[model samples]
Target: MSLINRLSTRSDDFLATLRKLLAFDASQDESIERTSADILKDIQARGDDALLEYTRRFDQVEAASVAALEIPRGEWLAALEALPGEQRQALDSAASRVRGYHERQRSETWTYTEADGTVLGQKISPLDRVGLYVPGGKAAYPSSVLMNAIPAKVAGVAEVIMVTPTPKGTRNPIVLAAAAIAGVDRVWTIGGAQAIGALAYGTASIAAVDKIVGPGNAYVAAAKRRVFGTVGIDMIAGPSEILVICDGSTPADWIAMDLFSQAEHDELAQAILLCPDAAYLDEVEAAIARLLPAMPRADIIRASLSRRGALILVRDLNEACAMANEIAPEHLEISTEDAGKWAEKIRHAGAIFMGRYSSEALGDYCAGPNHVLPTSRTARFSSPLGVYDFQKRSSLIQVSQAGAQTLGRIASTLAHGEGLQAHAASAQYRIKPD
Candidate 1:
């Protein structure tokens, strides 16, 4: 049986069907929310004691004190050295690429002097500290360590603390190695809502961070959501999503594997292909059937494709570009001749992979761009994680006595219109009497 849905723009209910397929429920689980809230409160109240207890309960790692869970900086370096030469080289190369890319994204402080001697500008500064949460054990993601940490470091963050669970006291050396390469300042063996609480609220052992980032389980997501006001979060991302616009020129096998790349992430991950060529869609379907059995994560890919994946036939490449804008996928691949031409038509997408050779997997790993992207159509208003996410901007205003006279009237007028008497008076006080 064919596992993926096949549709065409000619269908009467095509738009409605597309909307239903694109729908993703981003609501937090009520049970997880309640549990995360309690955990956050417990950590806030009891601090280290509560953290240790939860770590023992959830991760099955017993520690006498929260300090015992802290992984030394030397250990991170040791992990980097212990890796096989090829793995170490890969990690170093990826780190160099990520750092190089983000170095360009660093926003510099700028000022402009107006004719009236008023100095107005913007000052950019990195966060004082940031928390990175890496999933541990079997779900280790070294690439995520580079994606989240390198940007903070490049933005000149004073400290970057990392938290990862060590289930049954097991640690993944690759993750530690990545942390070292990415310049993570500290690592704590903690996970779930408790770890988020420690990062947000701070304890005797763990210091509070200005922001927390990286992906985690449902409980972790809920915890991040609840603690957002206390600290900045990257984004409450939904399941991974990829939209591929093919122009019938790329190989069917390549397209099939590109879809599999994200579908294998989880069962809810959406993988959609929009093309004008129905015959090419059929070829890709054949490739999926032929290739599915060999993949180790075939079950996950199958479930994800069957549940949320689609192969939609559009009128032409223009229509495909229009549809892609509507989806605003986390990762978008344009597999076509002159992919850049079609890419120019795209308005919304977290990241765009151009040309037939540019695969989404490359962006997830060695590519310089951040892999932590906006999901669930959030690309419409949001953006990919970058150095900017770890940096804060402050408006600089230095008004001369002469300039204040002109500016104060404008400010007082707006403040009074809003019925803010105090605000109006504060601005009025700056106005010079004629």
Candidate 2:
């Protein structure tokens, strides 16, 4: 069997074929959603009691009180200090870069005075508290910790609460270390839908957060979906995706490994390559076959490549750019001499990795951009998570008495034309008698 799918833009039914390849069923499992709903309701009604019970049942960890599960500030600091010199340096550098990048994203209050003495502006304010959910049970993603929490801290969030499940009462030190470096204010060893419930509804031990951000299993996602009205959520991510547009100048092995970078994320993750030269496509395919055997996650990479990965032969660079805009992938890599020139043509993508050396993997770590990006073509309408996600803008407006006379008269006219007596009367009251 072929290692990956091959397609050509010249095919008569290429669009239909491409649509079929990109098809993904994002529907949540009914059973998981139902279970999550029950968990949420129980936690809301029972508060701390239900939270502890669910944590014990799901994580297999017993705790006398919710406070017992809370990781103290000393533990977070100790975790950071205990790391090996090299490991600690890398963590510190990554956190520093993430913080620096998000600092520029912070929105500031601004106002402009009109000629009529009316002030119009926007006031930006950070959330009071935010919750971050990190997946646990053998999976350690310090990158996730840095990506989510650093932005909140940079946005000036007063408190950041983190929850991670500790299966069998084991905690991953690197995750804790990252929490310290990212300025996470508090953490608890609780996860799944119950943790989400505790954050959204507020248990006796934990206060409700203004927003929740992070990735988790289906149960956590379902809980977030249910509690969206009560609190804000980042997004319901689809899958990891990387679309590489090559000009046939980059090394085939480099392109192949780039595909594997995202393919290794999961079976649903997609990695596609677009190049004008058919020969380069052959070379990348050959490289994929040659390199697949040695990868540590060979099975996962193979599954992802075989299912959603593709090597497409486009008519030219322009056609590749067109296809990329259609896909609106989570990550876009322009591997060419004039990568910057081509990037200008791109209308949609969560992040653009330009030039032959700018691999998507770098952006995932310390490249100074938030790795929490839009997926499943949502890049067309959405954006990467950053300080903006943790801050809200309030419209600011002030009118002088003289300005109010004119504005109120206009409002009264519009309100009367719209046939609202109360609105018209309210606006007329502000107008000066002639």
Candidate 3:
């Protein structure tokens, strides 16, 4: 028998069982929250001294001053130059694609004049600076650098400062190389809540940023939560997720490996498959069992698959698409013939991988769209990070004399209805006495 759960739409309690299987507790740990609060307060009060102390205690990197932790531009360039030809080429290619994609998302200022000469428009401007937090040490992700920084640069942010924890003073060359390619203005050797604090609150060495983007551990998540009002944040993301809607036409081995891709992310990551064919589900189960022994992260995949993963048997592809919308998975793959025909039915998903060949892994790396997507059903309301996240829009209103006369009366009436005498009088003052 397969370790993963199996459910059928034919069962009376199928929806209930599916809900139970999909349930995930996203509550923040109290201990992590308290520790993060203390760290943020200390960093806010003591500035560079507190930052240095935390860096030593958490990352085991002893530095005399916070300035010493800042990686120089020359070093980032050198790391890029030192990379192997193939690696450098891949980085360059991915960066170019990402940059090109985001350039189209950039917003331009626009205005229109009315007949009465009332000019109304919107002014779009980029944030002055942004902070990107990259995971370092063994959990290095160069792709994250491109995903977060390039969009901010495309939006015309003046500076992009990056923070990555260099555990035991060990830095990943690929991360530094990505920083160079992504056009990060500054790189700081820091991590944890303290890094978020330094970026949000600013230290003697590091300037405060308008926003902070990227991912980290529990403590970092807590820090971002606490400092949200002080600085803008991308989103409080949950675990990685992938929900595949297959029609039993795709190869069982291909489907099994697709499930394994997300399962290998961590023990909590979710990977589910929905299909109408019972026999094909059995084939996938066999494929999973056969392929399990060879996987490098087999233990993690097994735990994830056994815990949150499921092989859900739907009635048809239409039903599968409905369930996908209800799930609002971070990644949705439609692995069937004429995938586009089924995709029209999907209303919510962070990213959709159409066709059997478009793997979620490709979207994670070089696919032009952003990899930092909404998770845990947030695709229902939230969106993928892009150039728009780094830009702000201000409404412009220039009322002509004749236009104010007409607008003032409408405003005064509404103000009076709302029982705001001062507002009514303010609008009345704008109206020319006739």
> What's each prediction's TM-score?
0.97, 0.99, 0.98
Report every candidate's CA lDDT.
Answer: 0.94, 0.95, 0.94
Error of 2 at 222 (Å): 1.1
What is the C-alpha local distance difference test score of candidate 1?
0.94
- The lDDT, on a scale of 0 to 1, for candidate 3 is 0.94
lDDT of 3 by residue, 65-128 (tens): 8989999999999999999999999999999999999999999999999999999999999999
RMSD of 2: 0.8
Q: Model 2: per-residue lDDT, tens digit, 28-52?
A: 9999999999999999999989988
For residue 145, model 3's alpha carbon misses the true position, in angstroms, by: 0.4
Model 1: per-residue Cα lDDT over 281-398, one tens digit each: 9999999999999999999999999999999999999999989898999999999999999999999999999999999999999989999999998999999999999889999999
Model 1 regions lying over 4 Å from their true place: 412-433
